[model samples]
Target chain A: MKSSEWPLVIFSLAIQLSAGIMVIYDLFILFPMYRSRVAFPSKYHWILLIALGAALVGVIFSFLHLGNPTNAPRSLSNIGTSWLSREITGVLIYSALLMGTTILHFVMPSAGRSLKWLVDLTALTGVILIFIMSKIYMIPARPAWNSVFTPLGFYMAAIVMGASLLLLFQINHGSWASQKSLAILTISIPVIQLAILPIYMSWLGHPDFAGGKGLAILLHNHLIAFYLRLVLYLLAIAFGFWAFFTIRSDTTQNRLLFAPALLAWASILAAQIVDRLLFYTQNISPEGF
Target chain B: MSTFGFFCDTSACSGCKTCQVSCKDKNDLDAGIRFRRVYEVVGANWNKTDEGAWEHDIVAYNLSIGCNHCENPACVKACPTKAMHAELDGMILIDPNKCIGCRYCEWACPYGAPQYNKLKGIMQKCDFCRDYVLEGKPPACVSSCPMRVLEFGPISQLIEKHGDNRSVYPLPDPSITRPALFIRKHPGAKLAKKLNASIINREEVKE
Candidate 1:
């Protein structure tokens, strides 16, 4: 691919990442905050709306990667037989549900638990949309994407990436951690991601599914992507271990732990982006990879 | 009165992609946007047979595809904005203004015809060159194909003209989407009745 294609590739990766990550935020972070009675931070709502906006922007930007702009609506006509069509319909429905819930929750705060059901419904809808999106790429005809494990990996990777992004934002805002205890929780997220990485890769590289274009991207694509993933995984494990050990120690400086924690988080973000790019590039469809 | 359709003769299609090129030119398509594409379906093994006896039973078929203009188009139903519409002539179209940069249609199309424009923040697709059709001329793709493999007219007339050739096969069958485009297989390549019966039985058993 030329340098011209890089922007489009990055944009596409962002869209895939946002679709997965933003849904988790809606389900885990934002909705939970609203459901709880404890006063935490008003910033959460602003952050979520921003995330939702970003997700929409990400989706729109990815369209620039397509060959044509005018004929895009024709995609809707084939939903009866196409997974892509289902994904489109699902995304639209979820977006409507989310928008409705968001408006009602913020604009009409007195709506109370009635809006909770709407949130619940939106969350459920988002989950189904994400699943459909994953399946769109998981056609059995394409050996590279045929595995059941790929979709789960995508969902998990989204959470890992999204949480890390939100984590960074929280850290910068100084609202994420007041003491070392909160820092420990932040560190654990990447650690879980590190553990999940190997399991997902093992599933992806199973003997029955190994050696296709998709497998090859992860296994042998470029020296850079492979090395980047390795470094990211190692950083995640190392910092996770260090945070667990040093977070409790009085002598350990917060700055020392914070730096590596941020680095490990960044590395995971990079790895997931690389993985998503490889996913699209390795697809040997009728258009060729 | 204007349910448009395509009758493609696989026996005559040489995979020149004239139809594909014409569709692109007619629509002023962006780079890499193809409304029609030809596919070759290579069937049975030939390398295993002896050289003299090795008659390659390759039923190479060219698929000139655009919107199927189905009675129930998945794309139209999926569009939240109702930007995609099925015309009375059975042509599927999209109004770019109403498309909110959402790509629901892209995912909806099994044949991958709709191309999303990031610049305009909308979707676009072939309109069957309705201008030419209104002027009593065939669509650009139909006229441009050098091999004359593509025949476009009213759905009923075209079906009546060549439906009984016993070589044509429409895509995805009726159950999946009921796509209007028809595919004609090469002559002498049709499955024998006994072979077809056995194949149907095997499929039935597997199902």
Candidate 2:
């Protein structure tokens, strides 16, 4: 189980990032555009395509996690009862909706306002996808994962990642007012995450479930990784604030903001990656699974 | 419906490896893959008497487990493919052809009953020795137990005879899966929990 767990770490993070980006791209980009406050170049929607590409990468590696993937289509058979099945189904529907939206953006460039509904649909599915994905891990068998922190960690990562990536994307675009909102979002989720760290750790220290052992494993075996993720979060926060202050209404200063924005994105991407790896290490099943 | 299951007399199990060995041999399982496992749970507390002599409170027991064919089979519910499913009699079995070998069922099963067949890329576990059952014989683990401490039959009969005690020490809460296993606890089982006993052979038995 340990040996095979790494692929899932990659698979979950990639899929979640893709879902988050699709979602943020909608709220941060689409809604404003729909309100006539800003006009994004048709090329801007391709960020959704980039998100789709990450999802494709996630799907590819997810197969690596399977012992036999030829039967993957059958993975959807138990959707009536299985979260795993629903998750797989969600991925398919999300990717398809995103793909349809992206393709329409290119094929029917004049259909912009008409296609807003489609893009909105894609984004809604992404949210559902993340929820279903989180639900898959909340089963009772692994109490370490069956907690509030699991979904919290997941949603926060998506928001942080999406905001940073979108902040970087929107730095040179969007109305100055919307840019402020994006910058604030980029800076705040990580702050909230930082605040949650000690509390999450304390939750793990309890004897209920295998949390005590999970905490022990975290402090003993993965202490360095834990510290590394913390440092990354701090760096992410610093960079996020740096990027936020760098954002100015003046279009010329947008060029100056790119450095801090890109740095913030990089820092956050690294933190979330390390955070996800640490999440898997907590699989400390009850005494003996 | 048969609702086939196992009954273990924990008080009589001598921590012998025979049931574990026989199951492996009968299944032709590769190393590290086990259909039945014996868990040696041991715990201890030490105190000094006024006479300066050391006194000990030690608890030890063996728990033999296979899949309980849980009525609320989490594996079946967690399985992406319908690979792991329950039959009409409430016995859980994996349909290898449908299994994607995702190993999700492994995480869902509390008893660690499902074993990943790395070579086959599929999950495998005790089917209550279906061939032998049909032939009116006990599963290999039960027949080979030197203490005659293991039994297999319809779970209803076993629960009636064993007095319906499945939430024994060291085993997880049976309510999670409602596993069909029935047990007769060893006297020390309660003390094992109080002393925080742990399985000593984790490496050998872990998937």
Candidate 3:
């Protein structure tokens, strides 16, 4: 991949990770147990902060991807047609909602309950943002990226990274209500992502899809990066399993879960980065050799 | 709308690259940047005769291409800043002032027309020589072709003169962008079904 696209790799991964975490938190933790648990608000606060921080960093990386960062404000001008414009608008809206939610949680915790719609809004926007982000690469010109696999891969990265980070947070905070179920769920995400690898690779190799030259480029020039991405995915899955078992086995709660948790997070995040890099590198446009 | 387009006669092209040079010279493009490129599409196979003599069947042709100024320009559709746009004449243009230089248009274009200008830090491509066209003068590449193989004018006129046959070996399906390009095929032009045909000038035209 061109070194210039590193920023985009980081940008997509970070934002999708942020969105994934929000979706996981809302679906698993907030919606089900928030009313019964007093600590839910504080947990939500920290989670929102993490998501927002990631999204903000993603925005910064996106700016770095541009040759003229000063002109980025005009990026939303083509929302009528451009997926990039839609993506920018989606992320900005999500970030703004997240900021508002975080502010409400800190400034007036009591008002946060009434402003639950804001959190829901943020989560919805975040999900839509991820979809739009994927759509940006679904160009008809780039045969490598113009497929169902692109969006599927993007969502998988989001879910795996998000869930991994959330599990780490939960373990560190000693919140054990649904940790087992969450771990089981999170562990499955990477497995599912891994499962789709073969299909994506096969599609890329097909003569009707990426064509002969495209396959040659993948097998020769990007072979190392592609295998490394696969290895990273496996490593992430292995770490996830280890973390899940550790969480399950530790009845006394005295055992150190930090190592596995950190490893899982790092491995999954690294896998996502590698995957994003491959996505950019393997983009063989229809007219490109 | 008067849609501007390109017409290339692959049969007459000599692969001399005079168009490429003229374009670079006129635009002052950098070393790796080329607005106009001539791709050599080649196919070859050997056959054994009944008399035990080997016969070679080889086909080769040059495709001098620039921006097609597509009727459904994907670059314009993908440009987040609307920097890639279509004028009243339907010639796609890049406005450096509005461009963030994200290269989204570069990726979206099937013709590989949008080029990143590192010196200017923006996307650049043929604007159908807007300044020259406005003055009723041909584009540099069109005027400088030593083989007289390239032509440009309104899409309707080009089609009327040349018919609508834009597909060539190594080029993607023209229906994708509905490129306003027309072509007079080389007598030995390789068909899309010829899986053996390959673009030989890939490294030379890489941008």
Among these predictions, the greatest TM-score belongs to: 2
Q: Which one wins on lDDT?
A: 2
Residue-wise C-alpha lDDT for candidate 3, range A188-269, written one tens digit per residue: 8778877877777777778876465566776788888778877877777787777777874443572566677788788888
Sort the candidates on DockQ, descending order.
Answer: 2, 3, 1
Query: How are the candidates ranked when ordered by lDDT, highest leading?
Result: 2, 3, 1
lDDT of 1: 0.57
> What is candidate 3's CAPRI-style docking category based on DockQ?
medium
Q: Which residue runs does candidate 1 get wrong by more than 4 Å? A: A1-151, A162-227, A249-255, A282-289, B16-33, B39-63, B71-74, B77-80, B99-107, B115-124, B135-137, B144-148, B156-175, B187-207
**lDDT at A205, model 1:** 60
Interface RMSD of each: 10.2, 0.9, 1.2
Candidates 1 and 3 compared: the better one by TM-score is 3
Scanning candidate 1 chain A in windows of ten residues, the lowest lDDT window is A173-182
Error of 2 at A125 (Å): 0.6
Report, to 2 decimal places, the DockQ of model 2. Answer: 0.85
Top of the candidates by DockQ: 2
lDDT of 3 at A84: 94
Q: What is the TM-score of each candidate against the true structure?
A: 0.62, 0.96, 0.94
Cα-based lDDT for every prediction:
0.57, 0.84, 0.81
